[model samples]
Target: MARIGVLLMAYGTPRSLEDVEAYYTHIRGGRPPSPERVAELQERYRRIGGRSPLFEITLRQAQALEARLARLALGHSFRIRVGMKHSPPFIDEAVAGLLEEGIERLVAIALAPHYSRMSVGAYHAAVREALARRSAALPVAEIRGWGSHPLFVIAVAERLKEALEDLPRQETMVIFTAHSLPARLREEGDPYETELLDSARRVARVLGLDHWRFAYQSASATGEPWLGPDLLEVLEAIARQGEARHVVVCPIGFLADHLEILYDLDVEAREAAEGWGLSFRRTRSLNDDPLLIETLMALVSEALAD
Candidate 1:
């Protein structure tokens, strides 16, 4: 019997400081990064323990998801593989491999919770390109968005509660942040920002968080403006208000503890908060959490049933 392939995709990270240049170039659409930009990225990676564990974490997620699928599906055969957008085991490669394995049916799910044409759509395009190149006619089902999945919302809200366990909830302002995209996408009516905010709202509603809000983070340095109010600006504004001294940043958009979380939030954001005399803490990333695994399984089951 032919097996079903579940391709788990994520925004790839550099394996080590040495891969920084290549990773940066890949993100820039093959335009190599300047030496200064390369050095800056290398320093960020160095600060976060000299490398990102994203690939390994994603692999673990795939293994766990495969096991769960096995138990859930019984005699059904399901094989899971990890795909990266900008690193090794690229989406196109993963698609090709699944086709080679005789997987007639595939479910391609982006690790990202929200959908954006620029992000999740790109992964689908990669799969299509690979199939076109191989002259294969495999049927692929894609999970476009699960931002408001109940289990996912609950899991993130639980993490937020854990982060606020000791901090005074009344005094703490909860900021839910997602990676920023080019502002032009807004004009294009990309539903990413809307979907992202909807997810955050669901989690906040679950936790009964009245002081919760949303912001954008990790905007690119492309001169053209990205989404806002940026996370750092939100922190500074809270300081100015002298209304809340404790702030909990929930990275609603990211599923793992990659550079954006490790360096951007832990290091840069922390410093900014300290400078503003505010206590800063970020909710733990849901990396390989059982809840996350369950969420993926739910999505797969739903896709297969449909």
Candidate 2:
């Protein structure tokens, strides 16, 4: 088989105090972030473990893809490797290795399902930049957004089903939450918010669930209107109504468990839910789910087909 490469990119995480400044600086475009800010961010990572499991999780993902490829006779003709936008294993390195491998074609996928200029577009930028520096032109294809992929829908819906099973059975609302983008991105005609809503509707349909609505999380209110009603506001609205029994949150944006899933949903949102006199619960992250691994392999297969 002719040589090929598969690149997977994600919004990387910091594993330690050793990495915190550099990671944040990369996210901030090399601007110096305050020491206080760095410390706080490190604390967030520390809450989950002494380090971020992103690299480890990503390696596991790569290994799983390799095994699946081998079993299906795909092999490493399409070598799968990971790159992080703001970490040690940067996209440029991943691309350079692929180029060095004498691979003639490439396929790229972002860990995030929904699209946004700020997130997925960043990965696209990495590829474009890498190709520019290379001596050869490579045929590359990227999966735009799998918000509506059949297996993708099934995976998220099943998680929602599990959440529904634990609810109190009457007037429970499934609050669909995803990371927020700046309103400017929306004004620029970025379809992130719209696509997120579309994913939420599809998942709700699959689970036969109604009374569900999308909310934004991980928002920065620094003098800009972010997408809303934010999760807290949604909880406030439910509190005012005083009728709902539970607010089950399902994070459709993130495929793996991370600080946002742990702190935002489990801690911040949970606090709001409890204080507002409503039950709070969030569906588990896909986090290396075997079915999700299959879906990812299918995505790789589709990209290669293209």
Clashing pairs in 2: none
Best by lDDT: 1
lDDT of 1 by residue, 187-279 (tens): 999999999989998998888889977999999888898989899999999999986989999999999999999999999999999999999
Compute each candidate's TM-score over C-alphas: 0.98, 0.95
Q: Candidate 2 lDDT, tens digit per residue, 1-306? A: 868788888878877768889888888888978999888888777766767676778878888877787677764466778888888689999899888888888888899998887889879888889889876587888777888888988999998899889576567988888998787887799989888888898988887776887888998646888887788998999889875878899999988877788887888889989998888888988878877888888987887766
In order, the Cα lDDT scores of the candidates are 0.91, 0.83
Best TM-score goes to which candidate?
Answer: 1
TM-score of 2: 0.95
Per-candidate total of colliding backbone pairs: 0, 0
Model 1 has how many clashing residue pairs? 0
Q: What are the candidates' C-alpha RMSDs?
A: 1.0, 1.6
